[model samples]
Target: MKRNSYAIIGSGALGGLYGGMLAKAGFDVHFLLNSDYQHVSEQGLKVQSTWGDFHLPQVNAYDNAAAMPACDVTIVALKTVRNHLLPDLLPATTREGGVVLVLQNGLGVEVESAAIVGEDRVLGGCCFLCSNKVGPGHIHHMDFGRIVFGEYSRQEITPRAQTICDELNSANIDAQVSADLGAVRWRKLMWNIPFNGLSVALNASTKEIVDTPSSFALADAIIREVHQGAAACGVDVPESAIAKTMGNTVKMVPYDSSMRIDYLNGRPMELQAILGNPLAAAKASGHEMPRVEMLYQSLQFMDKAAGK
Candidate 1:
């Protein structure tokens, strides 16, 4: 496979993890980072992963999209709260059909990306990794790391997608291309629906939320509501799948959720994408998600109180 230049829109934890690893593999990866961390790229990126530590010497970094060169694939890993800012990152310096991977956490990515870059060039993907930025030029992987995606609009699967899969697999990343990406995304949402909000509400880790009786019950209720909501939207999400998602919460112990981390740092929460979107879909399908609606209302109330 021919190597391609990769541009990462968000240089935070998730983007840094994938972008740094790709650059280490000798793909021409450029991270559109904040100006503060641009100096680290002058030398190179310092990736601290569970796989190993790497001081990639050949990594390219940029602070703005204008500085990036033509690329084959562009990874969008920004938080759901900043989904509106995506227009600034699309339209990369690449051919018309260049691959655009949406590595976001919620369901609206494909819809959102298609509006900006058109459906033909967009692919729906989800990251199954847990990572956080520990410092400038550094990302700490908390647990599992892999990515799965598929074309959502019946567009031809670009060689760039297969090449990226091979690259990630070669690096020991358990990457896969989903045959039914909507199902894959709904599965991912099963986990995010409960954990993301409960973690923020309790100010606790995933393990803590699952271990305690009250929090565990809250988590279960939220999952049930989400499953019903998904079914209402004509998505065939199984009850067994919902249980497995909750079970993984215990496995992902010691890991703080994205919402919890955002709340801790006083950043604006992604309640809309994480909670509101699913609730809206459920309502649109004439489904009642009382538990999720409660949680969503509480999060919105909290956000308003925090002046966020």
Candidate 2:
């Protein structure tokens, strides 16, 4: 595969992890770092992951979309709460046939993004990693850093997705093209809805939540609710999926979820996208999501307190 120029939108955590690795692997990578633009320009990007510590010296970091170069591929790694803000960040580079890879958290991001950019140009992806920004130019990757991307609604897989998969695999990253992107996304969402929100609501870690009986039960219940909700949306998640996800979560080194981190940092939490989308699906499918509803209400209460 020929190397391609790549643009990263919302270059934080997952963005930094994937983008930094790609840049390190010698791809012509540019990052739209709106929040850390100035800092990255002055100091470059500092990524500290289990893989190693990397300081990118020649990276193209931009705050405004207008400053970015037209690219073959664009990765949308923004938090779900910031989905509405993406149209203004596209610049001219993302239009036409350029593939927009949605490597975001939450369930309906593909739909939301396809609504803005045409469905044909949008691809769905999920990052099987835990990472966050620790400082202006530094990202702390806490766990696995695999990135899986593929076609969502389009008939043939776009060239951009194929090229990216090749580059990522060449670099020893866990990257693959799945036939069912919707199922892949819903599978990830099934784990996030309960674990992420409940961690935030109780100010607890995954391990802590799992160790406590009441919290553990709550987490299990929320998992069941999310499974039913996915079924309502036509995604069938088996009963054992929750237990498997919990096992994976337990393997990660101790770290707080992005929701809890956002809550602590006084930023707007991503409760709406993380929990709201699935709950909306459940309601639309005429399924009751009492456990998810309670968790969503709890997040709302916390958001109000945070003035988000």
Per-candidate local distance difference test: 0.78, 0.80
Q: Tell how far residue 13 is off in model 2, in angstroms.
A: 0.7
Compose the digit string of candidate 1's lDDT tens values, residues 57-135: 5467777777787688888888877778777777754446677788888776677778887877788888877888887
> Cα RMSD to native, each candidate?
1.9, 1.8
TM-scores for all candidates?
0.93, 0.94
Against the true structure, candidate 2 reaches a TM-score of 0.94
Best by TM-score: 2
Off by over 4 Å in 2: 155-160
